[model samples]
Target: MRKGRGRRAVLAVLFTAGAVLLLGPGAGAGAGGPGSVRQDGERPSFRLRTHEPHTITPDEGDSIPPLTPAFGNTGPVAAPLGVALRVTVTDARFDTIALDTIPRNCYLAKYHRTLICEFSDAVPAGAAYELAEPLPKVSGDYYAVNGSYTYSVWPLGDPPAHTEDYTAQYERGKDTAVGLKPVAMSTLKGDGESTGDGEDTGDGEGTGDGEAKGGGEAKGGGELRFVSDGYADRADWGIEGIKLRGRIGEYAEASIPEPTGAAQRVRVEVPEGTSFAPLTRQEREGLPSEIDYCTRDAEDGNIYCSNPRWYVTLRVRIDRRVEGAEGRISVAEPGNGDTNPGNNTAPIKLEVEDGPTSIDRWVPPVSGFPVEHDVPLETAGSDDLASPPEPSVISVDGRTGVILLVAGASAVTLALEAFRRIRRARNRGGRRVTP
Candidate 1:
């Protein structure tokens, strides 16, 4: 009996030791436990993505939705490009998804349409992710509404220095073509007929249809006329001669004479097989009489004047009598206008439309500029540049709960074994107890 009791004592001690070992470490392994304390001094690096949500409304006669903003380029020099994006629609009835990465100002302009946005960042290559499902088109001419969508972006490869967030607002408009033309009485009247349908009931000599025939579709019909005596007047109107040329559309191939100091050239496009009349004597006579007033005498006795110094006022008329088509007519003299000639000198080519003809502005060849990396010496040894650790999500579900309950029961059993051991040891010397 003493040997049996000795074995019981040993069993009790073993069970108690095992219980303490299991429970002590297991309970202390939580997030804020000893291990976490050791890692507290370490910093984590991360890349972030951010963007605003957007809603768009179509104009009265437009058929397609506008271009939507997506993720732009990310990464410092020599780093791999990374991109992450998510687009989900809560309601799938009226919205359709189309992705594009055209670099215009700060927006995204719809391709082949009048919609425009101001997005001016390079998009990362090979980092596009889309989840698109078409919505049913609503019946009738009523506006179709799209359900709200949420978009989230993250770096796919490396963490970014910082994440950006933006929501977009879109507005749609009907697409229409603008016709440019030069001003002349006969040309204006002729344009009126071409631009208008056959309905000419308005004022006599007017097409009544509200359409104007722009410059009779003549080939090279509206070329600027220069005379041997030179152009008239400095500051004839509000425009500078050199600056004025930038605002007008080029329709023909023409050269400005280098020796004449003429910085501006005007040319107009005409339809195939059309010819324009030469400047009439009367029109030539109308040239400003003050032409010699702007001439400057150089040491060689040759006269010289900057093209911007001369300005003339030309009239513009639009004939809206035609029914279907519309037209514009502009006429201006060679010029330096009232404004400072040097003040308005932005690059004319830069101002020219760079994207599709339907749009008015140029998109940059590259969207986003790559990030620069030249850290200071003080920060070189810091762990702030370290990569972020992978994140693990904690979840509480039925299965987890069941496992926890089982663990708790196991722990309780361990306690009972330990208690039994202690009680038996305390009653060691006593007589046998009744069952």
Candidate 2:
């Protein structure tokens, strides 16, 4: 009886070991569990997480203490990893501090609302991966308050496996007063419409058709205004010219701030087949002397100008043509203090008027060639056709050459008349003509 009991115990132990091997880590244990092989047989399991600040407050510039996100591999085997970060803000104005500074491996998608990052480095099991450089600073308008921003990180190609705490409340502090606002007009002149106090309504209101009302005070004590006239005319010779203007004003309520090293500028982009040309002395007659213009480069299609007198004008010429071409005009690097950023850009459309193109104007029609004319050539010199004038070589130019050319033409005319007469006579007698 002792031997039989020992054998039964050994058999039960063997059975349990077999069951563990067949059922994986434990009974009822799911795939993706610790040390468990996935049913689909993918090599890596990832734990991605997003770390966001509890509260964000807009400062004079970019906010400090940016969000940091990370991902880690949990499986036993090392494998390539991909990460996707999605930051949905309460307002469209809330965005990363600078888009150009994002990681090289990361790319913006879904209208810049998402970032997909694929790591080139192999992710070793149990190792965490976080951004080496500082992440973007989350920013919002000065008036943005109590708005929430949510962010989530997951495997790049998989979304259902996101972390449990994917969405969190992002608090915005009280409204910050300093900001920049830009206003644009489709034409050079703004309509004579202003509030009774000659100031904008402070609502950032404007027409959607590329023209906007004036943006109130250059908040943050900045006094310069950059404006561009968005009209381009295509000349008959296929070149276009544009004129840009600027306006300067004082902030009576607040003193104008001193110019910083990163001074504001107006940037104009010429249509593709065209480029910016420096204005000639004649063309710069009425422009303000304080406004400095960029030098001309044929290959460069952009123009940059600065300074803002009460009425400053800058003229640029685009000496090439591209049909139906459109360009953009805006203020570059508006800085972090800007309050309103939407009204900064306008469109430049090249106008093509009704008429013939340059091609039609230069080339004459080739139809109805050798027109049948009733007028006949005179053959009065037929007697001199017995021997056609011997060919002559002349190297002289000018009036002497012209006289020789006229004499040679006369001899050729006589020979052609003689041939015509002989042909007519032979045709009447059914014989070949020899001239």
What C-alpha lDDT values do all the predictions have? 0.27, 0.36
Model 1 lDDT tens row, 1-435? 796677667666655555554455445333321112212221211111222223332333323232132321112221133222222232222222332222222122222211222211223332322212221221111122223332233223321222222223332222221111222223222221222221112111112232211101111111112121222334322212221111111111122222222233222221211111123467657777642112212323322322333332221111011223211111233333322344222211112212222113211111121111112223334552332343335445755755655665565576577667667876896658799
Candidate that would win on TM-score: 2
lDDT per residue (tens digit) for residues 170-238 in model 2: 221222211111112211122322222212222222222211112111121111111111111111111
> In model 1, where do residues sit more than 4 Å from their true spots?
1-69, 73-82, 90-143, 146-150, 157-435
Candidate 1 minimal-lDDT segment of 10 residues: 214-223
For candidate 2, the 10 contiguous residues with the lowest summed lDDT are 246-255
* TM-scores of all predicted structures: 0.19, 0.25
User: What are the clash counts of all predictions, listed in order?
Assistant: 39, 4
